[model samples]
Target: MFEGLKVVVGLISFILVYRTVTGNCNKYLAFAICAIWLRFFLAAFHTITYPPLIVGFSINALGSISVACLGLLVIPTPVFTLKKFFPFFLFFVCIAISGFVNMKIPGTINVLVKWCYFLVLASALILSVRVQGQNATFKKLLVAFTMPVALQILSVVLGQAKATEADGSASYIGGYNHEAAFSMIIVSFIFVVGLIERGTLSFRTSLFTLSVFLLVLVNYRTSILTILPIAAVFYFTLAEQRLKPSQKAPVMMIVAMVLLSSFLALSFTMKERFADIGLLLSNLDLMLKAPIYFSDAERDIMSARVYIWSQYIDAFRNADLLNQLLGFGPDSWKGRFNLYAHNTFVSYIYEYGVLGVGSFVFVCISVLLNALTLKDRKLSKILALSFVGFLAMNMATMPLWNIEGLIFFAILNAVLIGHKKSSKSRQVSTDNRELLNAN
Candidate 1:
């Protein structure tokens, strides 16, 4: 029964991607959005792979290709700017150099190819959004992105799907094969919250409520922590402008009650898993003083991540100059530690080196600053807040390399940057009109 459902869902997903790509007015943008959602289904089906060369073909590669092809076909005269392409260029060069130096032919080829695909996808998204309009494209992309997540939620509720183990223990999976599901939910929530703030979507929607429930089920502590402050800020912001004084008190009381009840319910249902967090917190002092290299017993208590991070730091310190500046190539960490760095920043540094990491950071900061300077201050604030949430989540897990999470990251950032560019163009046009009228 489960297998049949998976096949049905996968078929529908492919049809949707095909229809959106070929049928939409803005085919390039639609193709990109469709490809992003396609990752969700692909991951679920476990069909995305590159065989003996790279094992699993990433959603990044699939989505990138989809959008890149659309751009080539429809926008034969597509524009490219150094401001947009330079950072990616530097980062890819670093990876290629590192890969060649390391002599990991398969890994090197894989990294180079994936990075190129990502660059193409990013470029296509920005160009498509520029030719179209940001507001319309964003709304369409949001709807398309939400569909697979809704399906996933349904599958889990229907008992057609089960979580995969994160550690040796099964508790961390939270009913999905990868932790990226948790990140996806968080990103989706950010989008929903932005919509609510804009008055485009109602806060009381069933989908939003169900999403909140799924988030709690996922049991990602960092995401939970990030959501609290965002929720509070969102509520306070909205209440001041949108709510009556009488309505504010009751709304706050209701929210508090709901949160408290949810916490109590999770505490009882996930006692053992929650206890692991409590134990980790209780042993914080011991953890700091413990040896850099932990024993199996020590690792079990510390969740093995501390020891892994320590190993990564030591390896980086001990690497040769060229490797230190460029990195030891993609997936090189797996050779030494048998696992990827759980942290995104650490992973980037390990795989792409100081120069690559620097370029990536510069691009992020540039987009953020551009977002902040937007005339639509509300959306700008939401974008800025969402980026902060993304960064906070990245500190705990490496989502940039994960297919589903990378789709969310790439799409969200691309939309924001495209919107910023569009806004500037409008400002320039308005200024030109004013000058002509004065003349």
Candidate 2:
């Protein structure tokens, strides 16, 4: 009976989220759909059978192919010269060669799953841009992206209540193993929403402040600390408000001095909490302990990541041209029991080899480039900060490789990328246009 209930609930949740993402049918909704699917696939993989691998791979490969086809269907065929195509081609080739040469194909199913994910993501991005001409469309996309998250938050709160009442623990299913990471992802989205919704500073500040407090409760120090400072800097930099000419230089100088002093003080205070804040507020010392404790684990669990990375590096060294392309096919890292490289850099190397890594890096660079191109001051700051957070969070962990991590990264990417195009409207733009666009 319990099992039946679980299945029923899962189905309902899945349907709700899917409709939330695709019903409005914007490009961003497509991105949201893919992000949710990535979470589903990763979660479902652990529970599903092995023989079904072929079926899963076929479905996902078709999805990727479909994305490329769909993009062509909607948008102008992205003109590709040999110069542009050659580099892209070679990059995939290197990834394939490295994986095949190393025989890192045990997790073939997982790789296929990711391919499907990327395919869907690509398709969603294309759709999002195409539907941009409509006003109601983007609002629907944002609502689709956010409303489910709001529901999830409510569900979590209810679960927490039930757990407390029953003296039992509540677990989030569907690829969410790390509660801290999952909470951080949700918080990241809220941060994005706050950016899109322009109101008084007090309102925005209160929202982010509350978010920071909740983050502390969740104890995702890496993401909270990383994202908060970046978000603040990004927000302030992009904000339209500026000091008068007389006060500007002195204010800037004071701020610069405070920042410099703080950095120097932090560097000296490493591994020790700063005296000013209590256990709840000060995290610099705690940040140092994860590595230290993990490094000292009895079974050497943390070192396992190093061992896997070593094997991958050696494989990359031996890889050749054709094998270097297209990747060793997906899910190439299964059976190792080590879910990720514990580092996004290592994860990229193992999954895409050098080529896929290059492409991934290229995409990040593209986002950064587009961030600068943003017309709206607030939107640009938010994109820049999101990117910074995305990159920063990877320092200690690979949220991108895991469901909890990927959801945050994927949603943020979808929203920020959407902002890049939508921010084109200037202050003098049509009121009708203003009413239609969300960002």
Candidate 3:
């Protein structure tokens, strides 16, 4: 069957990617590149589920294993301090306990295994870069991060160029699947901000701009709303720093021209969808009040998200003490609600419980604090801003456990936190050297 073939192909891909990572190549870069491909491309190929034994087998699972292995191979020692490791440990333990007590054995094991994989992989990535040195590691990571966006643009162009049906009706899935457009937009936004912070915008401006245009065309409204403001702020800030007064106007004009062209193109290609935006705006108040004031039919017009959220609230309120304190288990919401919570915080509370959710919040706070410590660094500030944006996006979207979101979050946090530690160490070394010289 095709399911078996998918598993076979995934294994082969994992092997090749693992070998590439372990080889003389830049291991961190190789892992980053492979992670992106596995998350966006290979994982999209198939989903194989046999239930209870192995719930889901996909390229993402294989990719996580390979990256974890690479991390273990490169660092051969514990790289995380207790402060950095405890929250995740507590969170994982809570999930395990919650699942076991709930008798959701299969889901508990699945959740634990996946979290273990993510933990090892994230830790390895941070330590691997530490061992490799920041300058070299950052350069490789930048290329690895940008490569997918570049390939995504190429895929979109090729897809657009392909001949359509005899009736001349074209399907506009473009580069990635339509379902994944929101995730692509988030990654692309991060890429643009990261490159700008690194001072490589001039070299990559056209490609990044094209990627952004395609992402907008894909038309995930929440993603557009979340990313655009952040992108604009970061872009203008970078422009101010990098452009001379004499050059700023021309650069700004070029940006405006490109944006206007993209808007016109979208308007022509997707007139109805654009009109729908206006319609939605007109009915915004009704949409907002639909859950309480309007009829069921009107609530359905809002795509049922508000209704679903209401159901989640009801479920939480009626949960047993154990479920309320710890949560049912990972993926356990489906058994009761027949769907995902569709909100990360809701999912966390429903699946991982209050303890797990609190641990996650603490981890996020720690990352923000670390970012703030590097206040003078523009990249750190931009990264902190991006993290906040990502967290906000999670409010309306359940991206916490998904492969693309996990990989993006892990890589960004690892790189930023690792850099912070390295900077501190360097400063301490310099101070010691100065003391010695003075003595």
TM-score per prediction, in order, is 0.75, 0.57, 0.72
lDDT accuracy of residue 398 in candidate 1:
68
For model 1, residues 238-275, the per-residue Cα lDDT tens digits are: 65566687787788777677667766786777565556
Model 2, range 241-284, lDDT digits (tens) per residue? 46666776777677667656755654354313222223323433
lDDT order, best first, reads 1, 3, 2
Name the 10 consecutive residues with the lowest summed lDDT in model 2: 160-169
Model 1 clash pairs? Answer: 49-57
Candidates 2 and 3, the one with greater TM-score: 3
Best by lDDT: 1
Candidate 2 is scored at a TM of 0.57
What is the lDDT, from 0 to 100, of the residue 47 in candidate 1?
40
Candidate 3: segments with Cα more than 4 A from true spot = 1-26, 47-75, 131-135, 142-151, 158-178, 181-189, 192-202, 243-294, 421-439
Model 3: worst 10 consecutive residues (lDDT sum): 46-55
Error of 2 at 242 (Å): 9.6
The TM-score between candidate 1 and the true structure equals 0.75
C-alpha root-mean-square deviation, each candidate: 5.6, 8.8, 6.9
Residue 292's C-alpha lDDT in candidate 3?
A: 52
